[model samples]
Target: MLSMVRRPNPVQWLRYAAGGRLPDHLREWVLRDVTTRTWFLRGAARSSLLVLPLSSVWLLLPGPLGLRLSLCLMALLVGYFYSLAYLEESCEHKLVKHGYRYGSGRATRNAAKDALEAEAHARYVARYRN
Candidate 1:
């Protein structure tokens, strides 16, 4: 039935964050971005990582207004990246369940082969007199 563990509540969420757990939504949301191969989500996650450090530094700059804005941005980015990481991990786990691995090989090869063989067999039979 594809049951997933429930997401943490607000208090637990805060506690998890405080205890150094990234604020990932967990479960299918993680897999949704990764296994589903959503380009937007993947790209956002990659770009977010690239930007995190720069944003951190920017928050430390001289201007108070800029610092406040940057801090807010940093928090936002952290949440985004946390979700991304969780999604990526979830997707990876899901893929592994189906015998897929990133950079291991083309995961769908067996399925493809089966499909092609079926098609070829049908075509061959269609062309025979019998």
Candidate 2:
């Protein structure tokens, strides 16, 4: 029997984190993995969205580095924050044994969602900037 708890499935989670748009055609293709089917680790691509930027920053830092290392560290911090914010947004719904609750009449939940979205955008830009 299926539990009443409707946990965030992989596609829904990634789509939520992507802010209602797939990052690219390749990413859209990967979303098909969300369906239960033959698979080798679903959601890997979406998880990489959370990883590649930080890994790039780490690899790009100058050796015996100057301000570049500091900059990369700062970039990592921003990525950390963006991940936290997105996680919070993706889990904002409170699942009770019976049903679910969102926002819950609290101004803070919506405030947090907005703040996280903005932070996610900022982090994306910082990571992708040439």
Candidate 3:
């Protein structure tokens, strides 16, 4: 099923990062993106593209090289910390932009997690409660 879903090309992804929408054909791919196991990592990577350029400007400030580098690292860390704080909301917004309901992305992820927990409990019951 996933094999049939087409990924966005680099240009399309850049547009996506800039808040543009993809075509409807990529809707399933969008859902998978927001619900996958690596969704948090993917969100961090996406946010880094926006954060990196801004942080890099600190390197151009007039100062000792070590001081400039330290400021750049501080800015990068702060940017990433804020990005992580809102990561789930950011992913949900992506799903909403892709035409899904507001909370559907989180719902889908929770459903997958619940299924795994249920399967684990079933295995425990079968082994110990029989």
Candidate 4:
């Protein structure tokens, strides 16, 4: 639940604060944990930062309706997925900064560690291994 939000670095805290205003109680909770910031990117604030160029497409594609449509669709998808990727990536820095991860990447380090440890187990039966 809370893992959905990774604490941000001290320097990046400004980015979170700049996005929008939070209620006093909520703000207190966030400030309570300097380890990570709420990744709750507000509606337009975060999405506005998306790198889509639909305006350029309209300007450049003066003809070919199908091509333009396809390009527009592609741009929408690219921007959508790119923004999601950015959000996940933005949270990833917490793994190194705090020795813990949050958001979608949370437990990834633990999972990897578990996998590595499993590989070293010496009590498993041959049939179980297979």
Candidate 5:
């Protein structure tokens, strides 16, 4: 179980973002197997960096409207990024909704490996047997 007060550090968070589980400092949040492709894709989708450049579009408006629009866009960007970044601490209860649960990274990887190995072993047995 995760501590109510203690939060995962940046390094641990990086592990999570990389589609791995948090270190021992944090418990497993994901229950099912997850592939790196899915992990990276989700992280990329959650990224707020896209708005940084898009917000600049307001700057090209050429008047006070541009200034106001730019400020608004910047503000929106900040709020968006803030929410996305802090989702971990404030996000525990909601992880299930996204189909991720905190769990041991090693365990997950081992499970995948075991599954693959089992499949391979089965194939070998079938091919060599009379």
Candidate 6:
């Protein structure tokens, strides 16, 4: 299954991050990328890549070292909060940009979540209700 999934190399990934679309061959990977269990983490990491450099500039301003560090940390936290708040929409947008229909990514993610819940419920029934 892993071999069937062709991942984008670093350069391609950077381009994709910059709003470029991947080739048709990588569409499946794009769907998996936006729908996987770690999608939130991936989104947060991408958000940090944008936020970190801008926040780091605060260090160059003449200020107390602790103050500069605190400001940077604050910026990071605020950016992360907004990123999470918009994560689902952002992912759906990416899917659309990659040639997927709108809401497919959300549907896929929800399906996987529902399957997990169903499996867990079955286990609970077997252990406690039976």
TM-scores, all candidates, are: 0.27, 0.30, 0.92, 0.34, 0.30, 0.88
Candidate 5 lands at a TM-score of 0.30
Clashes of each: 1, 0, 0, 4, 7, 0
TM-score of candidate 3 versus the correct structure, residues matched by position? 0.92
Instruction: Please give the range of 10 consecutive residues that has the lowest summed lDDT in model 6.
Output: 11-20
lDDT of 6 at 6: 97
Q: Please list the residue runs of candidate 3 whose C-alpha ends up more than 4 Å from where it truly belongs after superposition.
A: none
Q: What's the distance in Å from true for residue 1, model 4?
A: 22
Better lDDT candidate (3, 4):
3
- Index of the highest-lDDT prediction: 3
- What is candidate 5's CA lDDT for residue 34? 32
Of models 1 and 5, which has the larger lDDT? 5
| Clash pairs (backbone) in predicted model 4 | 7-36, 7-37, 8-36, 8-37
Of the two candidates 1 and 6, the one with more favorable lDDT, higher being better, is: 6
TM-score of 6: 0.88
How far is each candidate from the true structure, as Cα RMSD in Å?
A: 9.6, 17.9, 1.3, 9.4, 11.7, 1.6
Q: How displaced is residue 2 in candidate 5, in Å?
A: 23
CA lDDT of each prediction against the hidden true structure: 0.51, 0.48, 0.89, 0.49, 0.52, 0.87
lDDT of 4 by residue, 6-104 (tens): 455544554543443333334333432432323434322445444444434653767788787777777777766766666555444423343443442
lDDT for predicted candidate 3 compared with the true structure: 0.89
